[model samples]
Target: MRRKSVVDTLREIRLLSELDDGEIAVVEKNCRWKTYGASEQIIDQHSDSNDIFFVVSGRVRVVNYSLLGREITFDDLEPGGHFGELAAIDGLPRSASVMALEEARIASLPSDQFQRMILSHPKIALKLMKHLAYLVRTSTLRIMDLSTLGANNRVHADLLSLARKVTKDDMTAVIQPIPVHSDVASRVSTTRETVARVMSDLARKGIVERQKDALVVKDLERLEDMVEDVRGE
Candidate 1:
């Protein structure tokens, strides 16, 4: 239900929210859309790959594992979110793995291609750097939370992140659809059972509504309050 152009796509992500008209034009000219099957490995962990991809449709799970075989989720990327950005910019190997959560369509722009597009646009590079810094800080906070918080706190944080992307008013949040419940569990560092219970509780309280496969959050203030209480740790 969203526009497929780079401008509309950038509007959905915080990083490119501030891009100017000229910068947007450059991105539109360079991005190329591609499709992937469900369960495909979009990017392998520790792989020396260098293309940044935007999810235009479908979902991706950014996951990594610990020495003890625990899978930690860095994020569940939906439409309008991007991955491989840090590696593409810094020439580093990918730090995490990305798998398609469903049949997906992605727009990928490789590092060399990105550099060619922005060759004369030094300001765009600076803007992107600033954006990546924010992601690092955000990821660190989630890591810290997972180390210290319980299931409730983790779920609360996840909801807050979802809330930020959802175009909503006082009573309805239209979040992009996400399948693969295990992906959510990984990001929260909890079991899927816990997420299910919490969601059931929210549904009972009329704070959320199931829209076929996706959720429509109906009470933003309560969701925020729950996260605030957890953060009070």
Candidate 2:
């Protein structure tokens, strides 16, 4: 077993807020570390998996590759995320392909050991179940947005999704810009130029303020107005 630092491993497990020191040791003792370069495939969808992974740093995109072999990214995993739990727990094939978006470090636990740990520690299983449920609900909402909303409204809903994650205050949500317009377009289901034009318009309207790393929501009410209009149409 290639052991990683326990302290460093714990830092990536913020999603497991209910797990305390004693429980954490069980987790750290089981982990192995690996590094991946940008664009590396971590796991192929439908492939057998005997390892569970926790992101130590950098980003991974969870995507679906269709029969036609096109990749559709559903979510991006940044720091403080854990995946591969589902396949480990259920002994099933991977549900999605994971690809590193940047150079990343990850902690891995053997699937057999993970299953044993979960049975021994009810809290671990409970916390993991809650986390998985939240992902399902969030994904359903994203699919709902794409189905019913206009591109503008989908953008608004997605921004709100980001807002809800940023802070409880809701007034100061940070939506970062993509250096590439095509990236933004994929998220909002619009053209690259359309996302650029609409984002510029929102900035001019004073509903969004651009800062170094984010587009801050200065006025959520004004932003929701755009969503409401889409629902009306």
For each candidate, give its TM-score against the true structure. 0.68, 0.77
Best by lDDT: 1
lDDT of 2: 0.74
How far does residue 54 in candidate 2 sit from its true spot (Å)?
0.9
What are the runs in model 2 whose C-alpha is more than 4 Å off? 1-8, 15-26, 66-71, 163-180, 188-191, 209-216, 228-233
Where is model 2 poorest over a 10-residue stretch in terms of lDDT? Answer: 3-12
lDDT of 1: 0.75
Tens-digit lDDT track of model 2 for 116-208: 877877877888888889989977767777788777666666665665566456556666552345655556556767767777877898887
All models: lDDT?
A: 0.75, 0.74
lDDT of 1 by residue, 28-127 (tens): 5677766788989889987887988888778998888888878887777888678888788789888989999898787778788776644556766677
For all candidates, the clash counts are 0, 0
